[model samples]
Target: MPKGFQAMTPHAAPPISVEGLRRSFRGPDGRPFDAVAGLTFRIETPGTIVSLIGPDGAGKTTLLRLLAGILTPDAGEVRLFGRRPDTNDPEFVATLGFMPQRFGLYEELTVWENFKIFGALRGVEGAALETRFRDLMTLSGLKGFEEREAGKLSGGMKQKLGLSCALLSEPKLLLLDEPTVGVDPLSRRELWRILEAMRTRTGMTVLVSTAYLEEAARTDRTMLLSKGRLLAEDAPDALAQTTAGRGWRARALKDAEEARLARALMHDVRAASDSPAAAPWLDAVPHGEYVDLLTAADHTRSGTPPRLATDAPEAHLEPRAPTLEDAYCALTFPETRAVHAALAAPARRTDPPAPTRTAGNPLNAQDVQDAVVAEGISRRFGAFTAVADTSFRVRRGEIFGLLGPNGAGKTTTFRMLCGLLAPSGGRISVAGVDLRTARSAARAKVGYVAQKFSLYAQLSGRENLEYFGGCFGVSGRALRERIDELTAGGELARRLDARVGELPLGAKRELALACALIHRPEILFLDEATSGADVCARRAFWRRIVDLARAGTTVVVTTHFMEEAEYCDRFLIQDAGRVLALGTPLEVRRRAGAASVEEAFARIVTDARRRNAEGFAS
Candidate 1:
């Protein structure tokens, strides 16, 4: 142990206990909005990991702030270790570590400087501080980057530094808010490993909030929240059991066949009110070669809807085990199946046109021509090489994904492609136009959505969209027409006049996407566009993306969610500024000998590390 550390006595009180907690805020309409309304729960175990899982605007952040004593509750009571916590009480506050979503680290300061400042603020000094610093450096993989400025680090490294700063004092209770939101899978796994090790060694209680439901499985217990209320709290397995018998998988022989069957199934569900046989099924979504279906567990007994046509000749339906995400969807959105089908209905009807092929001319072959191409792309900053000889091609109307671990040069390559960063070496082309000659013209043909929210926070959503539209040369009646069309049916319509800063994370994401499409460019570039969106919002966003692709819009996107890669036609995986693997999702999985895309990514990265280590030894 470092210093001022005390082990919890065997009979010590629980780390946290809450009773009738309630918090409300005034909405844009001047009406009271309950962020955390009448919530009641307790953390009885010590040294265990607990996760708060929910959609955007679900009150997870509010509850965390309340527990940290940063915000006083409007009503009810909260006890930390059987005592009320006071923000002004230094001794009380020192017992906990709170890392909000936006950690306050000076951008100009080096990593070591930030750590030292945080340590001093926590009143830790001398050997105790040094010892803690060394431990954190090793655990967070930040030892070699201590001299680097905080702003220069990649997204993943920045998060690691933030976490290291938070753990400097070794508090008994650690509170983290969405620590893995924009982080890649490899970094996310490493962070979890560090957290698990810390929990086991120090017996510290951890409470984290996350948007990814799959992450909840790693926690000792998961609490489900919605609209500022606790819907359920239980172990991962227990929650999965709630939707056990309702899960089913349907497989077809080919992609075309699968698509046809999926459409048929959806049609059956939508017309179920008239057709009793289809009424039993709740939802169906395409999963590669197969379609996953969800139905009421006791539909047969309920008799309100007849059983599905599982024996259909076009496809094969088999009962499948429920996953944590499946259970979460069932519990949180009971109408998820219908909602997904409704959102996807448009894309199913108008599929994108297939790439045309030339019969005789090899130069004009469909496979040889591409909308975007990069050959021998590289970028250097003084002595450091940020990108190295990266090459890839994106065909017209293809959903091409760029994936990599943090600091792997994804952003650098993305910037070069978008003309924001001039490459040190390479040739680039967009929309058959050479970027070297007509970069401005090429940029004009594409739309870009940045990784972080970039719109003016003070402006209303409508004003922001209108401004972006005008910047894209869309003015007069045309600009107004575009804005009205974009926000007509979605969440943006409801909050058109609300300030961008006041919107929820998901709503803000929607607004950014809408702004990017104001001019209807031929190509779209998105960098983690769905980072903070909820499951429903992500589904809706993808539906629109598919529609755009079908209408001849080429899409180049980067994402941390492994499952989202399924939507891509092809993807490129990079590491250490070099391409590690490039192929379709299934091809990459086969090369890595893995079961899923996530597993395949881990295998490829592990192999890359081994090769790099051998090169260093040689």
Candidate 2:
């Protein structure tokens, strides 16, 4: 038995219990603010998985840290197994395992070395440590890679290794903080599989925080947090029942028709002021030529409810079962849905129709040309190839996705397209300008939003926009007008005077995007811009993207969220610096023989890895 386990005491209380938990910090202006304010909750059952769901600044991480005994709460009582959770208590500490958002792994050490260090730290030694380490490696799919350096592993593999380290002591409870934030679909599934197996075999309790609602649904129970307050806590299916009969799907004959139907539905919802009890439109998510809309049954001024229109001439709407995502949206953004409806209405009214090529029109000929083209693009560092023979084209006013796991060459390709890195071989063109001959001219027509926040933290949001506007050659009165235009009627307008560093994660991402679009470039590149954003933030971000594409701005984006690919006209999948698949989302799914883009991506990468291993053996 482990040394710490000998000190542990049995209790008849719940695994976790908390009351009036609070934590505060100093703001950028040296003012005090509360991150977690008077939260009360309990985990009553063991051997079950619970999920913490909330937006960017909802105090999920703060609560986790407080429970781990890493940070002292300002005012609260936290009990683990009926005793106070004190880091100084060996018995209390030995019962829990915590993995933070950023795992601190020694990059220079091999996989096996890292495991040994963690195991020894937990007081496991000799034969016990060796047996535990071997079991972990086998369970995490890292048995063959024990000799590989930690730094050389991919993002997914590193996450798995981190989980193994957290589980070395075999604690009764595991606490994970957003473990799948930027991981690929296949690896994400694998991580969950390992967690589930641990629970089944050892009856260990698991609590995880996540931004993906789909992932939250897989847990036994979900606790929704907002502004550090527990709004609701219940089983996943029971929570989803809150918005039943409110989901609807609409299919159109063509892309243009789908856009038109979406606009008309928005107008109808806006115009129906008589129905005061009706829920606002939840979402207008687009999938190729179809758009799925979610809304509640309309209640008239007399309190009479009316069913949804399923046989309308404009669209074919069918009632669908509610999902965890729908329930979450209804709970979090009940009012913000109106804001989206209003924002999308005017864009549809003013946007021009798709241009058709004509024999006598010069403008039509120019419109037919591709906005971005890459032929045989390749990048190499010494003897290792980063991106190899990649080719893809983005037409004007289209959304194109570039997707792959980390260390899969997606970033390398993105950098070459943005002109941040030079390609070793290829012909690259942007907005009808050749990059090799006139790099400046080609760069001038593009806007880039990096994966991480790129702004002066100390500066105000408005100031950062002004600075970037001037850099893009918009100055004097034009710059001021553009800043006002971008911030009008959204969250940015309310937080213009706040410093960028002090703002919430969602607000910071929105400001970054506004800065990138200051000059109104013809093309845009977004690299994981929605990585850590919440459901509401992601919806607003995509609405802005759709509006930009409607106004003739070509978008090239890379994201880990597979659902986002449904909005793209087309996308390319890459692995190990080679293109594995390229087509519409549905087409790619069909070719991979999978139901969704996420599953399709996993299948493609799994096959590629198998083929590579066979080649090496030969």
Candidate 3:
């Protein structure tokens, strides 16, 4: 920004301020668990979006709950509208809206009915609520389907309705605990749009917790958390600026393909690691680079600086433009590569053990695949088609993803596949077992992690896992062995006896996964499983899933994080219950023809919208 432009920036007193807040929970053995040591922050405006970000075990959710007065802080104070958060003032609580990580909507009630109860709880009724209800349904794209039972709604739809409940009263302060967790990319985008629109119109004070850096980018300011500590806090633009001039994209170089060279220098680093998990390309630093750099003979490389000859001809340097991703990586993991290098057993990539791919006839693609084939699947509530003519296949051992905006057919598809809902139109077969015909057997062979942690929180983590294992037919010695393997020496095990509800969001997520995988199902379905956990937790969860897949588990996942598409062996992009595109990571990226999965997704969605528009015009 120019000097004059900087002068135009707004400066106002914070609408909410927190000082030295801390929280702790008692362990099963009566030990006090210090979750949040100390946290302090201030939000200046009602309209601004403030994000609390951190790795697993960070105090983000604890702090948010404390501010919402849902949980009492062990120490210090949180003030909203200059009053203590625990004021017990109905007017004060009414001025604030809080959405928990696990929302408490009545699954048995219709979407509109659930919203009505929540609105009534907040003291809004009659005509005023009717107006708000209409507005929220439109904002959520559930206008025609409000009469549909919440239990019958898709995961994304449930989340949207949860958001709508929070917004019905037009609270001055909004606390959203990972509101977009199980939503598809398209749905996430719509949610962002609604939040932005709400912000622009009401100047509402919005605070959110997220594991995604992309979501953080949407916030006016963000606080990075790690292990119950605050690492850094700053405006998005300022944080991005710190990584200026240090990032690039590089592909292979060929003699005849010189013309394809872009501004970034191309090189081959044989010694460098190449793991999808670590993103070797994105994380590569030039300190130990070995390459054949561009010379005066290569005019194809764009914006090349003048080169000078030296005694050694092995190295050439190029100035590259840094991106927000690069900046975020650099700031968060400045010596990440160096730290990895210091370790003697450093692998170049985040490669898991090789997958134990089952033996099957390659020519018989349709046979022996651990897949969910949903044919002619359709769900209807009254006159609305939540899912119509939806059909798809999730291949064996492939990390298949469902991508779409919110209120689309993603959740409906998942339910049909899992036999949670009998489709109005068709059939779902899992690993050759038809769900509608053999629901129990089909379900037993499938492991699922819901968008929200479904394990009982009041119970111990270990108990939850063991109980879930039993539900899936694993019991006695086998269950014990599996539990030991999942929990032993792992962080999940270390927190074994801890009450599930008392654990951090990340730990809760890990426990949920442990439960899902307890039965060693051939098919796994994760519905936005990593939505609200910290970055470290998200990383940990992905690592575990990759491990599970390598062990021959067929994983089907739904996520709002576009970057995760790179992890999928193949992915299907959906918008409004229709499959827009489907292919491998590279294929999808190439089809979208963009730098990263995030960019490709944006471009693909835009193209999809354009095509829809033109078709309608015709």
Root-mean-square deviation of every model: 5.0, 5.2, 8.7
Q: After aligning candidate 2 to the native by TM-score, how far in Å is the CA of 110 from where it should be?
A: 3.1
As for candidate 2, its clashing pairs are: none
lDDT of 2: 0.77
Tens digit per residue, CA lDDT, model 1, 1-618: 224345567788889999999999997667899999999998887777898987778899999999988889999999888878787776766778888786667779999899889887777888998898888989988888889999988877888888888888888899999988888898888878878778777778899998777788878799988889988899988888888677788877554464445545544444322333446665555565566777744463421333445533366667877767767766655423332333333332222233333332122343336878898999999998989998888998788999988888898899888989899998887766667777786787788889786889999999999898887899989998878776664556789899998887766777887788788887889999988766655654666676677667889999998877766778999998999999877678779988777889999988999999999999
Name the 10 consecutive residues with the lowest summed lDDT in model 3.
Answer: 262-271
Arranged by lDDT with the best first, the candidates are 2, 1, 3
In terms of lDDT, the poorest run of 10 residues in model 2 is 1-10
Candidate ordering by TM-score (highest first): 2, 1, 3
Q: For each candidate, what is the lDDT?
A: 0.77, 0.77, 0.65
Off by over 4 Å in 2: 1-11, 28-31, 253-280, 287-290, 296-313, 334-368, 615-618
Model 1 / residue 55 / CA error / Å = 0.9
lDDT of candidate 3 at residue 252, scale 0 to 100: 30
Top TM-score hit: 2
Clashes (backbone N, CA, C under 3 Å), per candidate, total: 0, 0, 7
Better of 2 and 3 by lDDT: 2
lDDT, model 2, position 21:
94
Q: What TM-score does candidate 1 reach? A: 0.87
Candidate whose lDDT is highest? 2
